[model samples]
Target: MKKSMLAIGAISILFFSFIATQPKIYAQAGGSSVPFLLISPDARMSGMGETGTAIADDINAIYWNPAGLGFLDYFPKQNPFDENEELRPFRQVALSYSPWLPQFNADLFYSYGTIGQYFDYLQGTVAFNFIFMNLGEFNRTSANGDPMGKFISNEFALGLSYGTIIAPDLSIGAQLRYIQSNLTPTVAGQQDAGNGNSVSFDLGLLWKPQNLPYITDRLSAGFNLKNIGPKITYIRESDPLPTTLNLGLAFNIVKDEYNDLKVAGNFSKLLVKRDSLGSDPLPKSLVTGWDNPGADWSFGLEYWYDQVFALRAGYFTEPSTIGGRQYWNFGAGVKYSIFHVDFSFINTVEANHPLANTMRFSMLIDWR
Candidate 1:
């Protein structure tokens, strides 16, 4: 199974690399395609204001920050619970389904799945992930208001990720993804209206220090660079991928064996330059885009009881110039043995928002 998983990952990376070399497209403000990639697909992370960069430690880490996978508690050579137990590592699998923007359309939805395992021989953790988005079906019409056939829009991504503990308190990870977006069949005059394929990469770092001199042992920080890739072309226009940089911090405010409280904050900035601005080289554009006006910030709090039940709440804010997605989120989770279930809801502050009253559901299974 391990060899098969690794082989699949290797093949996916190579396949996507070749596809990325094809001609690409560009976009203007709010013009980026494949925007589904930015949506939070994990219920736990969505419940926590989509602040997964620092607080991800489970199978969902494949989406938020693969570096956190390095922290999975695999069964060691000598199991403390059972000394006679075999020396094997634990495996985790997660599945999630979300009815996105139900307030606007009930048929549109998103789904995600991931599997992760630790290999003692490699001293690292590896995971495979898949994401899909269904934008629902729409009636096709010609520019002359003529009736045409119906069409459905969809997008998907296949990815493989790896993470390892590089130091006692630091871990790093990377993921390579193959993304495809199919918008419409044949537009009136535009050629190449079929499917667009692109490849992107994600890099993440996590710093988790324990037993600080005067501080708590539960504090941690994380950084992630996501969606770094070449431009993708739908037909005529070419646009950069939705590259972003995220920085986050998380800490346990109250901790004990029976109960614990945690809080986390994350800030994110788009790294792509605007079309109006003259294009700088890739290296320079990344640095210059830091000063861009569009930025997002989020905060979340969670409380757990006996490690079985959890309650969470969070707030997310973005500048009006940047999309103005201000909202509050709430969620809950329960775990029994190796099975877990989580649910999350989103409430937008602005009236008539597409994401108003959105919700997500997720399930997980773990074996040790």
Candidate 2:
């Protein structure tokens, strides 16, 4: 009947959303829910091969490697009598938007926003962020197959993060997230099987050595364990979260008063496992998931001129067996005073790929 059709349609929307946002490869893709959690939020990192764990020194670090916040300084005391008084941006804000799966033009879009404040007492930055994925509108139906009305479908996550330095050269960060999926509401006789909710957390670490022999302050490394939590159940079936382990390294190629260049690389592995029986539990899956044959890797480069303009390029690749998503990303950014704007484009190696030609725009404001 119409109710059954509505459920099917709602499921299709959820499926499509998941497929469109999967920027990397996963061995058992079906074992996870809310794949949007894995999406790269800002255009800056997107342009740089979706790599940021190592160069997470900005506000976007809330989503990349929150530990990077430890390296940032907020508003410092400034006075006419003190010549060494320091004054830097104390509040940070970021926003990003992208039309998801442009190849289909299905009215799908993704948006992100975050704000951070540095507390002098804590000596760290605490941030809160929101992510939303609009899956377009769906036609509501009656038992007779007649259109009754329209309903909007969407998924979102809200998270809080805090990062602080634990040592002179090392930092740690953590995030807590709440996720929700509103695929469809109970209509007619369909019992809202498309709705789901869950919670998760992320842990991250960053290291920037200043006393190393050759590397000194020119190298950075990061590790993040993301989306660790229980499974999400829509109505009956429960699925695991898109838990993942990411590692990255960044190196400064050139640094001077007028020019800056850096290169970064990342390795990511999905830590969710499922088989004919069903999905495995948390700690168990973390180990069993590695038994599967696959991982994803990418590299990126960024060059800045006079601290005002930047050009970026990156390459991303994965095992062919896990839905290989290889592509090149190019982007540009400009900064003026307290504002920064960035734009990026994706060029998939395989022509007509769902992600090809996709573009994202983002902006940031630093306030002192």
Candidate 2 structure quality by residue, lDDT tens digits, 135-237: 7777776668777777777899999999999999999999999999887777666665679999999999999998788767999999999999999988788
Query: How well does model 2 score by local distance difference test?
Result: 0.84
Q: Which ten contiguous residues of candidate 2 have the minimum total lDDT?
A: 18-27
| Per-model TM-score versus the true fold | 0.87, 0.92
Task: Please give the CA lDDT of all the candidate structures.
Answer: 0.77, 0.84
Candidate number achieving the greatest TM-score relative to the actual structure: 2
Residue range 1-368, candidate 1, lDDT tens digits: 11222232242232222112101112222234466778788888889998889977898988888898888747455446886777667589999998866764437688999998998887888999999987566666655756576766678999999898999989999999999987666666666775688899999999999878777478999999988887667676566677878999999998998999999999988776656553433555578666566678999998899989999999998765655668899999999988889999988898876677888999999866
Query: lDDT of candidate 1 vs native?
Result: 0.77
